[model samples]
Target chain A: MPDAIDFWFSTGSTYTYLTVSRLEQVEAATGMRFNWRPFSVRAIMRVQNNSPFANKPVKMGYMWRDIERRAGLYGLPVKVPAPYPLQEFDRANRVALLGLEEGWGKPYIVASYRRWFVDGQEPGMEPNLSASLREVGQDPARVVGQAQSDRIGGVYGAATDEARRLGVFGSPTFAVKGELFWGDDRLDDAICWLKHGRLVA
Target chain B: MPDAIDFWFSTGSTYTYLTVSRLEQVEAATGMRFNWRPFSVRAIMRVQNNSPFANKPVKMGYMWRDIERRAGLYGLPVKVPAPYPLQEFDRANRVALLGLEEGWGKPYIVASYRRWFVDGQEPGMEPNLSASLREVGQDPARVVGQAQSDRIGGVYGAATDEARRLGVFGSPTFAVKGELFWGDDRLDDAICWLKHGRLVA
Candidate 1:
């Protein structure tokens, strides 16, 4: 069996969006299977006792520039959406939970993140989400409604609970064989752990 | 007058240690004066929504291993001290405040960080603190007592409040002319901002 990587992600997370396009290529190269685990960014933020984007102006300004730089480096198109942090994550995350149940988790996560980060679309907006799902040949209304169901809500909650248990306080977190790696920058290390069964200590 | 780089740091922060040492050399080379501002790592962490080391095992592990790797790159000796968070930052921060008052803040921060991160000493431990202070010909007992006094304690509080107002949420944060650069990795950018008056946008 290929090594399984539990990918904890948030829909509105730019870093998570940055990593998604390349992740499948990484999995293919390393022969690792990514288990998509979508969770609420709000839930994780609550546990960490932080307000999203709190006390950050210049750093936030720098982040946009840095993201553009990184996106260019990766050959990805960058878009800066208005009302940053994009409060539409809830709807996006819900659809992600449905995708996980439908066994199309990877493609759904990739599409949703790309739509928000690269395509510059609001995640919770019905028209954009519908278009994204239609493009993927998944029924948008059904998927969105399913995402609102009690069962789908449970999945999202469970993922957040697991994130807390694993000591994950941020997005783009990766766990391989119970060892956690935080930040998009540490994706290579996570891959190394999967390939080698441990990090170089 | 040289551009003032406000350095917001914490005593037990390893990255801050590396930055402090390297920054001193940078100042000497480039001719700049740093207004060293010591603040509570706890407050910064809280504002950033990060868990203290005590609560996040994976983060704690990553931090230790990452610091070790970075220290090796910098040729700095380091040890993960007992009681990882080191609660006595209150006292250590007070001494730093005194150093600021005496106009010896730069060297004092550099020396103190070197003693902790480079020498593998517990910064909060009395013996280690005394040794570090005595090396600088400072009276540790008197400084410690004064640090606990209302006057100095108020100064530390004010610094933390100022950090919050400045949108600082982490250690090794540098603000140049109201532009903030966070993390040890951003020191170069901070210097660039000081010199160029803006980042390459």
Candidate 2:
């Protein structure tokens, strides 16, 4: 059942927070499964020479307000102006990859997003990340250390490369039968496609 | 009722076609009014030094796919790779302004979008624009001529400036009570805001 959908996301993305935090409720309500496919969306953005929010004040302003409105519509709690643009995501993403392997990734991702988006903590940052790891019943030292191993590093890179090859241009994209559905707003659309497929009416 | 909602659009924007072509059905279903506000979104982008699709082939690739899926979801027929980045939009935009003034703006906008998106025609280009004008009972020679005058130019410029002031960064925005809602997918969200306001649990 978990193989039915591919949920592609990056740990540092603002909108990915929405998807990661809400997927549990979505899973419960619909009885559908999501294979959490965490990858580095920022790496792909760099390769494409696209930095949508960098040095764009007006767009940034719009994004925060847009996210706020969407959070309300989704009945999710979020703190706008959440410390953004985390300097380092390597450790966080690798840990996410490791957790997915160990079957604790879901809770870790959700808790981290809650801290970053609901508690106004900077994503992929210290004390915060360590705390998030602990919240999911994982030892901070052991998991964080194992997350940096070369094996996990290799796995993470492969996932990112695979996402890039799949024509995924951003975080929080859903893939069904290899077709990419981008953005959180398209969650239901992805589900609709999963059930009925396209070309209706 | 037309005064209740402000519909902001640029003739050449790809996604505006979705809103313009489907708005009549939306109006009929809801019995609400939309004040057509035609403006040059490109002018604002020029000032901001921002171009999402320019020089980014990969992003453009993703965008085309996204639009195709969305068109399917909305039940709107669209031609992928419709002539884009229209070279001269000034004349066509002025004509839209004139149509709005003469109360023919709705059909004129809808017809133009159908030509551009469904028929694979370049937006704001002659023959296409002229035919669009004729489709809605306006003379091509007279309306097209009057559309280029200085008075129309001033009105167009003011509308563009007003959109910029209102923090509109994209086309086909729905503005209600001076609050901005960007993107075609946000139309329902905008209407929800209009009817019930925000912060619903």
Q: Scoring each candidate complex against the real one, what DockQ results?
A: 0.13, 0.53
Going through the candidates in order, what is chain B's TM-score? 0.87, 0.93
Q: Which pairs, if any, clash in model 1?
A: none
B1-201 in candidate 1: lDDT tens per residue? 467788898887756767877776778987877778888867766656644455655556667766665555566666754335665777778888887797665666677677676565567565677887777777878877777899998999999988978877678888887677778866766777788765442
Question: Residue-wise lDDT of candidate 1 within A1-201, one digit each (tens)?
Answer: 457888888877767767887787777877778777788767767665544355655456656665664566567677864336766788788887787777776676777667667666677675668877877788877887788889878878888887888777677888887677777767777877777765453
Supply candidate 1's per-residue lDDT for B107: 68
Minimal lDDT window, size 10, model 1 chain A: A50-59
Candidate 2, residue B71: how far the Cα is off, in Å: 2.4
Model no. 1, DockQ? 0.13
Candidate 2, A111-135: lDDT as tens digits: 9888888888765678678889889
Task: Give candidates' CA RMSD values in order.
Answer: 5.5, 1.8
> Which ranges of candidate 1 are over 4 A from the true structure?
A1-4, A21-33, A44-76, A79-91, A97-108, A118-120, A145-164, A192-201, B1-6, B12-91, B97-125, B136-166, B176-179, B185-201
Pairs of residues at least 3 apart in sequence or in different chains that clash in candidate 2: none
| Candidate 2 chain A lDDT trough over 10 residues, lowest sum | A192-201
